[model samples]
Target chain A: MPYRPFDGQNCSIAGALAIIGERWSLLVMREVLLGRRRFQEIKRNTGIASNILADRLQTLVDHGVLERRRYSDQPEAYEYVPTRRGLDVNPVLIALMQWGDRHLAANGPPRVPVHTVCGHDAEPRLVCSHCSQPIKAEELRVRPGPGANEAQRAEPLLPAD
Target chain B: MPYRPFDGQNCSIAGALAIIGERWSLLVMREVLLGRRRFQEIKRNTGIASNILADRLQTLVDHGVLERRRYSDQPEAYEYVPTRRGLDVNPVLIALMQWGDRHLAANGPPRVPVHTVCGHDAEPRLVCSHCSQPIKAEELRVRPGPGANEAQRAEPLLPAD
Candidate 1:
């Protein structure tokens, strides 16, 4: 498939999607984040074709999300490790997992996130940084910021309440 | 392209992706979330082909993420509105936006989320529900839950520290 870029949108979500929006990219990230870094281990977990996985991993490395490091000298084996940027994808994964757990999971969540700091199952919540209050979709709106173009700066993006 | 289902993964993230993992799906959700529900408006903003947009919207409606309603009588204009399931996608979008803002945005964030409740610019942060402390990717681990399959139950998914 030809690469279709979202560069014209001038929106950050679009920007991020342009990088990680492929169907298998996040699943590959999931494997690495779960500590399955070797080529075979990620392949075993995701059932993704080896060629596709190699392409995705190369893209991730090019994007600075994952760093490839030699792990074995004799076999010339390497492990893919998450850089800071890759680790930052945790929230996105957790948000998706929670959404699935609520609407799709029939039995229960297959995996639970445990916060090592609090020593309990982590139900991650999105909160406002300024007020430290939980944010709800209805209670949020968007305003043009420093990067806004003329059309965006002219009006708030969301509907008036 | 044939529909690829992630059902065999037994993972909630994969389940969620199976629904919205299409390249254009989340961008469509972004349009509706930002109050651009009209077909022309969405097409203008996202540069998505009309047929593709129609298909993505229908898929979202079929999945109960969006509710399509007639908004005009003479021309038979319709609009897409977010259902509870769709509204729940806000977190994923926000997480993606923040990631893009931090990594891709050269100037700054094009759109800034504002918390209507606190009347402040909302920098959304993911925090543990129990401890209410911010979550860093390194400080979290995953364990098998009630929905875990036999393989998942056999061991922890993430590496041990």
Candidate 2:
């Protein structure tokens, strides 16, 4: 029912999904990042079946997103912590939250990120890597790159600006 | 098996999984935005099972991320296009790609996102809302907002910034 192969679509989007695209993998990352470190804590917060949770955690560890470390020698408990790889998923989670808050939300955002450095609401903005300008949704366009396919190279792929 | 509910840890992240957190939903959005409009094209690009693809497509349409339109009257062919809500997901995909490229890539990224405006490898940076400065990962934190629960408000929940 899960772990379906992503199409080797010769694209990074598909490439990323191929790694983390499981049933509860991203949610597991969410829980761990949100300070739900223990197995039972994560399971209780997510209502995920124990088998599925264990499986997802194992896969994430195998892929280097999480590190499995024992907390206590007496009780022999384990906690899931984000490696650099896992911590990098914050932007992805922010993106998802912004999208859900925009559409599916009935009230308002359930939680808001604070940019501790700037001391303000950390509204994730898409800033251009080169120009360092904040990219509004209308300010983007897609052009073929070196990795572009035949059709892509011939005709540029522009989604919504 | 499929519709697992995340109980409530950081409900924003949990709630995020409630929508785009499914297996193929984000990939489906990727294909649609990347100019794969037809059913067969999306299925081919995603490698998702037909039934699962159809179900995801239906859910996306129901949620208004995508709109289905008849492209031809003869055979009545349809195409999927991202609404504003759907295009909003590009940052999420880009962020995931950045993550996968950084940690998971064995040699190099399978593909890269080019900022068409500047024509360089575009790493979409998250900036602070108040000032337009880049928000570094380690320099961000969060506090309870108008939406914080009693438990969330009772304690200081500082996730890794």
Candidate 3:
């Protein structure tokens, strides 16, 4: 399968961006996640042009992020719903939202994520799954993993000074 | 003070995307975050053209995500470093990397984040700060916050049925 030019870096960040890194792509996902499923609804909410929206929708569906289902037959309307893969983007969206809320929002966070199970204003915290302790950005380092290519493996340890 | 068209929507995810949503923008950040500080080094690592790299670097500096500093007076060489604001993007990059590793990687993750303090491989898990329990995408919902626009305020509480 052909990959984006940048995907040659053997980096997962680049690999992910090759799929949903476009501004409009994630915005489309936001709409569906927020309950706007119809084409017109997504188009209006995103203010994205019809042709572009159509293309993005097709690509998303092709990539298994969204599933197009027939919602009505009279005029043959359809709704796009997130698949498990699409739902997996929640963390990325939350991270982006939290960053914007912290740095961009003048008044406050525009929307806050609530943990429905716990019933409290929930801010997502990244924790070490093994230790269950909060993980700070400066306190983490990257190392070559099983999939690392030869060049990637040869790179120096991260946070090089 | 100019903002993206979607900024008016008052959504933090959209707000953040307005800043770093472009494919190349985040990729450029990844390179810098991984210690590729020089212009030529970033360009080579990201495979981005010189013009595009220059444009991204300028934008990142303009937005306060990166700072440009002179490294050599004789040669007029400079290095780009991530500002505090830019370093805050670690969670976003980690989220993207994790997603790509889980769903897109053919072998396994090329790089793994290790918690420096714990000395163990760290997979960031989203936890509810209030409860300190891991939260999954299916377990979260969004609600209007102080910054919500009137229109957003009026929208049915999120995850609306």
TM-score of chain A of each: 0.93, 0.86, 0.93
How would you encode candidate 1's per-residue C-alpha lDDT over A79-110 as one tens digit per residue? Answer: 99999888888888888888899889999999
Every model's DockQ: 0.76, 0.52, 0.76
- Give the alpha-carbon lDDT of every model: 0.87, 0.72, 0.85
Which 10 successive residues of model 2 chain B have the least lDDT summed? B1-10
Q: Which one wins by lDDT: 2 or 3?
A: 3
Q: Give the clashing pairs for model 2.
A: B137-B161
Predicted candidate 3 versus true structure: per-residue lDDT over A99-136, tens digit per residue: 89989999998788988888999988999977888988
The candidate, 1 or 2, that scores higher on lDDT is 1
DockQ, model 2, C-alpha based: 0.52
- Model 3 CA lDDT for position B100: 92
How many residue pairs clash in all the candidates, one count each? Answer: 0, 1, 0
Error of 1 at B149 (Å): 1.1
**Could you tell me the lDDT of residue A125 within candidate 2?**
82
**Candidate 1 residue runs with Cα over 4 Å from true position:** none
For candidate 2, what is the TM-score?
Answer: 0.87
